[model samples]
Target: MSDTGRDSSVSSPEALRSSPPVPGMFTMVLHTHLPWLAHHGRWPVGEEWLYQSWATSYLPLMRAFNTLAAEGRENLVTLGMTPVVTAQLDDPYCLTGMHHWLANWELRAREATTRTSGEDTGFAAPEAMRAFGIREREDAARALDDFAVGWRHGGSPLLRRLVDAGTIELLGGPLAHPFQPLLNPRLREFALREGLADANARFAHTPGGIWAPECAYAPGMEHDYAAAGVTHFMVDGPSLHGDTALGRPVTDSGVTAFGRDLQVSYRVWSPKSGYPGHAAYRDFHTYDHVTGLKPARVTGRNVPSQEKAPYDAERADHAVDVHVADFVDVVRRRLISESERIGRPAHVVAAFDTELFGHWWHEGPLWLERVLRALPAAGIRVGTLTDAITDGFVGDAVDLPPGSWGSGKDWQVWSGEQVADLVALNAEVVDTALATVDKALDQAASTGSWAPRDTVADQILRETLLTVSSDWPFMVSKDTAAEYARYRAHLHAHATREIAGALASGRREHAQRLADGWNHADGLFGALDARRLPR
Candidate 1:
């Protein structure tokens, strides 16, 4: 039966046995991703984004999960970390930088603490250091220490510990967050399979589901999703034609597509009027032009930083409480209303990028903490995607159309603006890299000399990864860091052209120059395994 027909029949509990006794359950999926940035660049563009995000988002959020799990809240959330991001997190260079960044963060906190303690009468008084605030700061410090220690001990091992301990439900994604709909079919398949394998090998867990980059989907992609052992994935609400279903496995393939119910999604963060825009939250767009950090309020026009009051911890806490209350109430209402209307408990799945919390929305981590704690108290039980699917409440197979969670819910974002040039460059690099790899393999077979192939293979692998990074197009489209995008695109393009030229002519001098340029540019993916290339 078609998805609509099946859902219609199952509208009432009497119509289908799949509907549960309640209205519906809800699960939250959060995506954690960033480009390969370690040792590439910093400050205005690259590694800074990774480090700041790790400081504000990853560490605090992971600490939240650890704390909740300690309180017996296992599997409170389902989180997907793309393999490329994971690889960087596990990289030695990244670990070293993080240790330095963590130390810097500690110094900042110590300074803040000292500054506050020295104050006498104002809001920043010495007595302002209350137990909760102290505990929060100390907890943040411990979280940073734990994270640094975890990385030293091995990021993959620490991640495995988190997963095995039930602190989180691990999720996967495509190789490099490709816009799969526009990619060549063979490349798309290879990207997905290799991505899944890489995730499995490093994390020690093979994901049964994935978060398609930008939630991009196309008809027949389901077959690939299923082939990669991805049992479920996310899609925008409109993409699913208003069918707010959870765990609905596709008919054409074994995979299921879960549509994000906009009702709940909009409550947390939306294009406008979301919780993130609340005056209490830290403003993301307008950073202090001097310090390169946020030191302003989202005040009404004409209000200067000096006039804006300090970050009112009380006001922020109150806003978090209200948002959490609203969320829990909404979830309960949806569950009750959907159950009454459909005659069985319906499931509501809300998904979002993990960066939204602390990186983009400064109070996001606090909001998440309150929301998780509030839901159960409000009688709205939370669930993870895997839990919902394994419990057997999913819709029948339905062929999904080509779509993405981009501008117009399509692939336009990656292909729009100056991004078009980057896209073309990416295509050229991929083609050249593949050709170079093939030629190198053939050379090794004929000359019985593996050294030449092995040496040139490094640049090929580097170009392949550079071509795959989603950042080039994303930065261009966002226009926040356009120059960086252009530089990366040109750098990758140069690498591709150089590799192809040297491989074609067997010119040792030219090849060495190209290798040196790649190294001098400090491209992070230069050290990747060439065997990852498709045969």
Candidate 2:
């Protein structure tokens, strides 16, 4: 059965009620993240990442989720929010700023609605008013209100509500979205564990599944995930050799791993031909030359942003319906085909950055709303990783090789030329930090003191974390905001160098200054639990 394979006899809600329970299961995973942005940088690119995403993606998606739940429907989606993103969402400063942004957004929508109303006064074509109706303006107002409520609560409450309502399964990831395979083994373990700890503290639920940053995977990571109480994680399709079967626990480890389904995933978004490139979707690359904002259509090739017409919600909604219907159809067909081929139902995992829905693809939330509702109606059940595991449908085990869902689904993002310098610096910092930790442990054991070189230990720990931040390379590669990345890399490198110099020269004051600087930054992992670091 294709995603569109709803029985002709089961066309209505009443008909669906009589239909057999949708046996085909589909899982949607949304990974949400942005590096530490508080007091970090802004504008041209920084905290704006938070505000823009909040306005475009988080707010709308939360609204959609809540809307479904309000209808007494169970929304089965998986959300993977990194700790850094969570921190900013909950930060006092960000909450205040987000509230302001929501107000501004509401005003913008109001202004657009007013402008459209005025422009309609002299309208001649029946299609003109057909295009601009009271319902459309009301929808805009509803979208604004929904966004304001979600943003006002700062997302934490919305997240808690969703989890409590069983609308979605929450997945945890690294504290700051670091690519674990390239990081030091111990740091990798610490990052994953500390991330889980942070999520557990905030959400009041210890996540058993993690969205490994970039979907980057390595053989030994299972050990770390197991240690952190994570029972399963995701990787790219190639990582598990295109096996769409339910995930299999690694040998002798409690952790299970599932590979992404490229077939179904590419339908919604891909390097090319994804829904984002649709002629009707919002244009991401080109901004209005005068306003310095995105206010244009993704008019097909040859049509420039400056020439593109004002956004038309109806056109975009039609596109959303088509794409979402296509997505549901694809999943249904895959489920039926795989079931027949493998003699068992196969799980189709569609995973993507949470930002893609509303940020990159402006109509994404709308599409999500339709697609999620359409899945079950079409005889495909929505599920979480936990549901998949508990149902006993898991298939044969295969070695999941190292891979990430980045460009080429490989390690290029974390280890490419743009990030090579930071990688080298991280290597040096890791070595020195590890040696310092070992010495501290030795000294503490001998002296029976918990306060051996607190200043030095703190600096080393701070430098270690700063060096391992995943921001540098990501910025460099995307060229989205390279200057900030450079500044941050140097900031950490300088701190690490200063701490090392002070440690060498026995200059306690210099070391103290570096530790104080780090303390002020107040990065969540700066004071990582030393016990969590591997021996």
Candidate 3:
């Protein structure tokens, strides 16, 4: 049904009772992604990133889902788990490392307690630090227990259980989360296929939708999506020219492109204003150097980190309640207004990064739980993208222009001047790696023997994918751990070059040695097969 020119105003309660309720829906889409961090680095930057997010975000998120599921709630969210992140979560090395990291967190908390009791220690505030440590210790201990019982085998089983139980609609993305718009067409197609295969292998179910890396797209991506069997994807609100109330079919393809309702999304988290900026919430920037804990709240926008107030759980919880109500009201009004404006039912997609829930905003999971429960009571229907589409929430076809959810709502963040060097580097690495692998595959086919696997070719593809991760350019542009991002990108690029060099020289022994070293260093995608690359 197309929109009719009708007044988009809600009538009074009496008048509303006379008229049928507007058919409206809300879909919460969370993109859960992280670069392959295992076997990369340790403290302050690498594996810690994975473990911290796992314990604080993924674990708590599972608990939230389990809580809702026990109450018989289903399809509460559309969850996107990128293949690279899945690789790490399902890796034996990462599983063991995360367990050890959790244990160490508990020990560190105890050590902080001991240090505070004995002497002044020159720490910022001993009492607050001690309290924070004790709380973190308990949290870590509980998370450890959860991991031992539920995640011992890896995250695949847990996630698969949720899918089977209909707790979430899983969305998968390409390997390494490359910026598909800029990537070579062949590599992009290959990555998408392998990523979908990875998800199917792990969860035993294929995702009908994908959360495009960075919510980015150029023209004709719909054709590729259709080829990959993707039924739907997401783009920024402006991509739909600000009319983001419904999912739009791309060009003439069956694939649907859902534009995120930034009005509702930014209300929860934005640079200028959001629930997380509340004074009572834990400050993400300010940290205790000695204990390595965030003890301060966001006292004020411009307040120095050292001057921020200590975090208060009660205060933060109060803020959560307030924001939850505010957000619910926002969604309610937006849905009604949109429905009335279009003279038809409307669908609103509020999408965000899953890590923002717990890792960035400490109280985000609680907020999510409350919002999910409250929306239904307030007469709003909450569902996944699949449910929305199945219920006929699609709009007219749109020829989407190239854009991302980044600053400027375009590709500047990934392909801007600041990261031009890395862009060139990625292009070179991908081109060389693909050419070398293609040549190797030709030689193998000519020999008519597929007996011994070409491990070097496999490693080359792996390195190429890793080198092109969108995280590197993003980090470089943000200047937050930019050096480490560059180093990692260069490391992968160099490995790809050296390995390809060995293959070109026909030095199987040297190539095998180098491949073995890289395989150990970057070993998340164990099931990745180089032979799958299209010649």
Q: Which candidate is the best by lDDT?
A: 3
* TM-score of each model, in listed order: 0.84, 0.86, 0.93
Writing each residue's lDDT as its tens digit, candidate 1 over 407-520 gives 688777788755777778777777777777777766666876453436566666556656667767777787868888788778767777876788678885788677767755
Between 2 and 3, whose TM-score is larger?
3
lDDT (C-alpha, whole model) for all candidates: 0.70, 0.73, 0.86
Please say which candidate is ahead in TM-score: 1 or 2.
2
Better of 1 and 3 by lDDT: 3
Please list all clashing residue pairs in model 3, or write none if there are none: none
Q: Point out where model 2 deviates above 4 Å.
A: 1-23, 106-153, 289-293, 441-459, 522-527
Which candidate's TM-score is highest? Answer: 3
RMSD each, Å:
7.2, 4.8, 5.3
Residue pairs with clashing backbones, model 2: 2-333, 3-328, 3-329, 4-329
